[model samples]
Target chain A: MAEPHLIYFADPMCSWCYGFSPVIAEIRRAYGRALPIKLILGGLRPGTTEPMSQKARDELAGHWTHVQEATGLPFNRAAIDGEGFLYDTDPGARAVVRVRREDPELALTYLGRLQAAFYGEGLDITRPEILADLAAEFGIDREAFLADLDSRDLKQETWGDYGTSQRAGVTGFPTLVAGPNQDGAYGVVTRGFAPGDQVLAVLNQWIEGAVAQH
Target chain B: MTAARRLPLLAALSLSALLAACATTPPPKPLSQGRGAWSFAPANRSESAKLAYGIPNSDDVGLMLLCAQPRVKIWMSQPAAAPPKKIALRSGKAHGVYPLAPEGEALLQATMPAADPVLDAFAASGELIADQTRLDARAANERAAIRAFRGACPAKTR
Candidate 1:
């Protein structure tokens, strides 16, 4: 019998994932020791050149509204509607990867804080400088964070994270997959944003099943 | 400039601080609506399928389908009491009414045509909207989803 692991596929710019942050935190709290969890970046909008159009912004605002209504998460409408705001998510995704490499434990915290900084405070998370600042606020060294952010290798590594997510059959942000072990075949546990309790219930079942099988 | 004026000013400051604190705190647990729980089983070896069953943030009851194998299949769960008379899928240049079939207890599934042009169009689109009688839902991050589906299940060469 192999140890089962949980993988979470998410994007920082994804609003639903932002709503699921608190729930994910709770999962980590309860099961962090029992199950080794891996976080992979699902690139939502990478290499997007054009600035967000009004129609796109309006549609995204509607999504934010829905998430807020369902989860009570706060969102900054002004930042979303601000002029010249590009919706590219690659920079933020790459920042998470960088954090994951530097401090594995801080990676999730950085992701949560980044979500809060973007959706909650209306900060532009797509900019490398802004991301570096956020990293510093999370106790990461600012200069080193910037240097790593600009490294060609890190960019490729970020793309690699996206590739891993795609290979794992993750189509949406905040997807959770369960596997027999860290290196085994994975089955989708939950896709899209789910509440903490619902996720835990399903995970608990999986844990019990694994125990029974062994 | 008297004590009374100072008292009101201090009270206003305290209220502002309290509101700011409230704004920063994380939200409470969401009300239980029986949304967001799913189970998974391996698909047939020849064809790969990833099914997500639960209430998505947007719809009442939702199931997301990603299939790769003979061709590409992307299904967004719809709210139909009975199977709809017509089903249509439209993106940027890829627009067509697809043949619908029931998937399990709920969900109507459709496979995109295997032609290169159709697959290409679907892959390039930013969003895909599926429509049926009294139900409509859009899939975001569509390009990534299409790419993942294609990578996992490639079209078989005829």
Candidate 2:
């Protein structure tokens, strides 16, 4: 029997997913080897044309507040309040995809750095230059990363990841689904932000169930 | 106390009160509940819909529509309750109860018929009415969002 796969559908720009980062780290420590984890972008606010409205700004600030209260994750209010900040998340998602393709090992680390840069430090991650700078910080080749980011193929793959999120019936970020493979039957362990211990318990249950089925 | 000492103490209290007030303020309503615009990406034929919509700022709740064979599956951020087996969905004169099913712990779904009339009715309706929640998907971009969804996962020919 093949080992079950745990797919994490999230966006680097999602505040809730940022809050769930510590929990994800704990899950990684507990089940990293036992269950292979796949990270896919959920494509939040991708392809957005208009600048975010003032109302939208207020709404997101409230969410950041809630996430900070719930998860104790630091958030910079200035990021959302910054002028002309369009919340298009495609650039950040594409950067993660590029890193995943080039250096799969650094993909998750790259995602964390992007989240920290955006939510914690209030850095605008919608720009390719910003993403490349962060990539350089992670020791990834900056120019090659930019080339992959602008490639037609990467755009298609990132869009494909959005479609994957839709087909997986994922409505929110930080969704964790466990299954046999990309094509095989999968079950959602949790959706939205959850504590590490709670997610681990569900993972253990699913692992036990998979074993029993075998 | 000296006026200088009282000034600092008063400033501290006022600042604390202001922070508390900001924290206690109710969250803003989701953009979907109002006349907010939504954008749709170009559809991908290999999978389901390549669209995204949510109540802005309510990070935990979102609505996703996927095209499956013979039916369009709708998923919401809200969890499914055991009762309310059926939900009445209406747009304009076309109204029906989409059978609600539990997709996962944090998601609920209602599968609508994929026939043209059903899809057209939903597309043409100014608002999607279900109980007290009304989703305004009648805007030009919202309609495009729906079109992209249907285009991605069209019904298979028999």
Query: Global lDDT of each model?
Result: 0.62, 0.65
lDDT of 1 by residue, A1-214 (tens): 3444567788887788898889888776665544556788877666655676675577567658888987898899677677788777878998999999977668888899999889999989888898999898878899998888879999898888878865664545677776644334456666667777677666555443433343
In candidate 2, list every pair of residues with a backbone clash. none
Chain A: TM-score in each candidate?
0.93, 0.91
- Give candidate 1 misplaced runs (Cα > 4 Å): A181-183, A212-214, B1-55, B58-158
Error of 1 at B73 (Å): 20
Q: Score the docking of each candidate (DockQ).
A: 0.04, 0.04
Candidate 2 Cα deviation (angstroms), residue A107: 1.3
Measured over the true interface residues after superposition, the C-alpha RMSD of each candidate is 18.1, 21.2
Candidate 2 lDDT for residue B101: 66
Residue range with the least summed lDDT across 10 consecutive positions in model 1 chain A: A205-214
The DockQ assigned to candidate 2 is 0.04
